[model samples]
Structures are given as structure tokens and as C-alpha cells.
Target: MTANEMTGGEALAHMLLAHEAGPIFGMGGFQLLPFYDAARRLGLQHHLINDERCGAFAADAYAKVTGRVGLCDATLGPGATNLVTALVESLNAGIPIVALVGNTHRLHSWKNMTQESRQVEILRPAVKEIIRIDHIERIPELIRRAFVVATTGRPGPVVVDIPEDIAHATYPFDETWFEVDSTYTAAPALRTRPAAENLAAAVELLVEAERPIMLCGGGVHISGAAQMITRFAEAINMPVAHTMSGKGSIACTSALNAGIFGRYDRIANRLIDESDVLLVVGCKLGEIATKRYTLPEPGKKIIHLDIVAEEIGRTVIPSVSLWSDAREGIADLLEVLPQDELKERLAKWAATVATRMQQWRVDVAPRLTSAEVPINMARLLHELNLNLP
Candidate 1:
């Protein structure tokens, strides 16, 4: 064989390394043994998981934490089926993952072969896209496509099903085919800002409103917009609230931070009730975030910004919807906002949030210090908070 020629498994491993795809999580099986051997030989980091579901979940967590595309794999049949729950979780949370699933040989497909099942059909609904590899030569190209699809736009899991025969099949490979696009290596591969007209309209509402608050969600974390959001909130003197998943969008100690707003919150709901205009960024304002769709009261003007257009009006219709990445949208708003004109008018709202936050801390102080035998949940949380870096 020529130096450019390699098996499907070797191509997959080589492409993964070229793209700098990190830490693969999976449980090995016969159908994927060649790829596993290739990975081992290539010095790729493979984390052996106890179950396929756990592997998928670990990948999901890796994506969430690193703001990169997570990688996982499973063999045919039961192994592939086990990843559904975690794939659904990643889909709903907008996390990026690339799942490699092994399948039976093409000849045995639909012939009642052992561990033979229609995995693409089974996993379609659970992922953003699913591609089955029929030709060994397309392995590297398809792997690159999977990364692009998984990380770009509204990030989610993509499945690439490789048949056993394809994995072991040798083919003439071009060295140029191994080139990967570095842009799609991480989540939020592209950043987009809102329209100029939408930002102007949102600014008008924000300037005139006596009470305006911001609500953020997981999109803030995905876009790595924490510092930008904090700066924006501070500049406008606006109170900021978060969903359960959106916690830590802003520093907890920041006076503008109103804490979690949802089914179980501290002071954010109170602020939301009093707000006249709501600036929602990144969050979907789903049932949990909106307290079963009963938040911001009625007739409150809303300005919604999200990377996904479909999520903008799915729950609560916004007066202005900015379909853009979380960081870029907020950066554009900050750039155009008339900050000098509105400091006096919004300072009172900021003061009110700070006062309420202090009062809430006082009210919860006793509970946090409780020394009950079973150890109160609040006390446990307080201890954890103290130790957090």
C-alpha cells in the first residue's frame, strides 16, 4: 500500500488528531475494535466508560465545561441505542457533540445479523444530524462535516454511523484530505450580531423605561459572554437575573445580580415582577425559567436575543428579537447604547436591586448557618459555596 493509503479506522483517528479533537469517551465493542486499535496506536486519548450512556453524558459535560465539541462513540445495536437520553439532553441544552456509532457490515444490513439494527433511524430525532458512512474513502470528509455541523449555529450532537466493513476497508487516501477547518473545532463556531435597526429599537425602550432587568440563560455560558454581560449590566445600571442553567452568567457578588429566576429563586422573581422592560439574552424563557410561563407579568415590553431564531418567540413573544450570538448581540448593544444620557434615570433601579439583595442575604443567613443533625440543605450549600474557587 502507498503512504497515502490507509484503512477507514486510521483515517478517522488521523482526522480527529489533525482537528485537535480532544478526549474521546466510549465503551469498546467488536464493531469498533479496529477504530479503538487505531486510536490506541495513534496515541489518541480514549476514556473507557462503563456504559455508552455514561460516555455520552461525559461527552456532554466536556462540551459544557470546555466550550468545545465533545466526542463519544458506541458500537452497533444496544450500544448506539444507549446514547439517546444524553443526546436529547445535549440537544435541549444546545451543547455540541459528535457521536460515532458502529454498525454491521453493509452486506448484512437488514438481514437479521447479530447486533444489526437501524441506528440512524433510532438516533435521528435525538441529534441535529446523522450521517452513515457507506464508503471508506469518505470517512475523513464525513468526520470533518460532523464537527462543523455539531459546533456551528445552535450547537447540538451529530451522529456518524460507520459500518464494520467500512471501518476495516482499505482505500487510497490523499494527504490533502486530512486537512481540517480549525474554525469548527469549538462551540459557537460563528458569532453574529443583531441588525442595526433592532439594536436601535431596543435602546429606545431601555432608555425610557423606569425599571428594566436582564434575564440570561445557558447561551451566555456557551458564547463565553460572562464578562461582556457583567460589563453591559454595570454600564447601564440594570439588574441581571439568570435561569437555573444560567447561573454564574454574572458574578454572584455583583450588585446588579438578582440571583436565579424560576421555580426556586431568591430575589429575582420579585425584581421581574416590578420590571417594566425585560431584556432577555441567551435564555429561552422556557416553562422552568418562566415559572410555568407566568413571569414579567402582563404587558411588559420584552427584548429577546438568542443565537437560535426558533427559540426567540417560542415561549414569550418579544417586542424586538435579535437573532445573534449572545456575546456579539450584547457587544453591539453596548456599543450603540446612550450610556451618558440614562445614568440618573436607571440608578434608582440599580439601588433597589442592591437593597433587595442585601435584605435577602440577611433573611437567608440563619438558614445557612443552621446546625441541624441531618444538616440542612441550605447549610450544605453554604459550605459548598465557601469552598468554591
Candidate 2:
């Protein structure tokens, strides 16, 4: 083949590398040899797993930790089928992943190729997009679109099925191919900033809230608003409660952290019941999160903030719904909301909440320190956290 003519596998590997896609993880199989060879030739970093299921999880984990689009692939037939579970999990968690799978060559499709079982049909329900490439030349454009679809809006997995024959087919590089930008990275493109009217509404509620509470969730971590959340709460003397997914968004040891509670948290339930106004940031407030829609209390004024508008009043209607990125929204509110005299106004209520939190620790301290054998499970956990900085 001439210099410009390269195998479809080479074109794919080059496209991914040009876009600076993150780690490529998968298991080896008969149909993927060309792609593997091209990846090696292009000096792309590839991770191997013994099982396609685990390979998908590993890629998903990388995406969760680094906030990048996960790159994973599986061979034709069984290998591709195996990646379905993790992709489905990613979909549920709103994690972004681009899955590459191999399929039977067009010539042998439905002709009973070994291990063949309709790859696209099996994976369609689990992913957001199913892009099948019949012509080898379409690989580059399809891959680009796959990245865009997987990372835009609510973020989920996209699957691209490259037929076995197409993977090995030679192609004269087309000049019409979109050149990947040098700074391009595999990440979502959702930009949410709260509207002025909504922000003002939230501020008005917050300013007059005698017992203001802040409830955070997984979206805080996804939007990278941990520090912003901490600053906002501390500035206003707001007590913060977290869901299981929202725990790491703020340190549990912080005075503002009222503790994780939704399902069966005494401290959090009492505070939620007593709060005059709740400022919910980045949380979906799902059933388990809001204790079957009971925690916000009856007719409590609520300001719900989230990137997806559908989640705003999915369960409990909010007085003000701000569809915006958690980090950006919090940062903007910080700019407009005054912090000087409000800390004094909020001191009594904030301290009551803080005292209740401390009382909870005191009430549980005996169980935590009990010398009884078999070690109380609660005590074991308390010990673990007691020593943590």
C-alpha cells in the first residue's frame, strides 16, 4: 500500500490518538488482531484484561476517577456481548464511555460465523448510540461522532461496531477527514450556568431562610464542585447533608457536614424536618436519596439545582429550579450573596444543627468505645473515622 493508504485499523488507531483519547482497555480475540497491531504501531497505551466484563469496568473506573471519556473495546461475538453490563451500569450512573466492538464481515453476517450472535442487537438497549460501519472509510467520522454523542448532554455510553472485514480493509486516507484538534480531549461538553432570575430567586430564599440547609449529591462530584460547595456552605453557615454518592464531595469531619442521611439517618431527618428552606445542589433527590420524598418535609421551600432539567422536580416540586452546573452555579451565587453579616444571623441555627451533630457523636460514643467482645460494627467504623484526618 502507498504512504497514504493504510488499513482501516490503522486509521481508527490514528483517529483515537489524534483526539488524545484516554486509555484503551480490552481483551484479545480473533477479530481484533489488526486493531491491536495498529495500536502498538501508533504507540497507543493499551490495557489488557482476561475478561471483557472486567475490562469494561476498569475503563469505567478510569473515567470516573479522571472525569474523562472511557475508551474500551471488545472482540466480535462473545467478547462484545460481555461488555454490556458495565456499559449499562455506566448509563445508570451517567458516566461516559465509548465502546468499540467487532462484528462479522458483511459477507458472512448471519451466516453462522463462530461465536457470532447479533452484536448490535444485543447491545442496543444498554448504550445511547449504536453506530455500525459497513464501509472502512467511514470509521474516522463515526468515531468522532461517537465521542461527541457519548459526552454531550447527560453523558452515557456509545457503541461503535466495526465489522471484521472493514477492520482489515485498506483505505487511501481521505483528505476530507476532519482533522482532530491538538487540544481535543475525551470529555463531556455540558456547560450549565444558572439564569439570573433563578439565581436571584435562590438568593432571596437563602437570604431570608431562618433555618437554611444544603443538601448535596453525586452531581457535586461529577461537576467538580466539592470546594465550591464547602466555601458556599461555610460562608453562609449552612448545614450540609450528603447522600451516599455525595459523601466525598465534602469532608465528613467539616463542621458544616451534618452527615450522610436519607434512608434512616436520625440527625439528618430531624434537621430536614425542621429546615425552613433547603438549597439542594447537584443532587437528583431520587427516592433513596430523599427517603421516598419525605425528607424535604411538607411544603418546605426548596431551591433545586442540577444540570439536567428533568431531574429538577422529578420527585418533589421545587420553589426554584436552577438548571446549571453545580460548580458554576455555586461560584456565581458566591459572587452575588453577601457573607459579612449573615454568618451572625445564621449563628444560632447553624450552631444548633452543629450541636445536634456533636450530640449524635456523643450519644454514639459509648457504643463506639464499648469493650465488649465481637466488636460493635458501628464502633469499628467509628474507630476507622476517628483516626482519619
Cα lDDT, model 2, residue 248: 72
lDDT of 1 at 22: 88
- The numbered model that scores best in lDDT is 1
Instruction: Please give the lDDT score at residue 27 for candidate 1.
Output: 92
Candidate 1 per-residue lDDT over residues 58-128, each given as its tens digit? 99999998988899999999999999999999999999999989999888788898877778899999999
Clashes of 1: 0
- Candidate 2 lDDT at 194 equals 93
Report model 2's TM-score to 2 decimal places.
Answer: 0.92
Cα miss at 314, model 1 (Å)?
A: 0.4
Off-target runs (Cα >4 Å) in candidate 1 are 1-3, 387-389
Query: Tens digits of per-residue lDDT for model 2 on 119-205?
Result: 789999999889988888788888888887777666788899988888888988864574764422544466679999999998898
Clashes of each: 0, 0
C-alpha TM-scores of all predictions: 0.96, 0.92
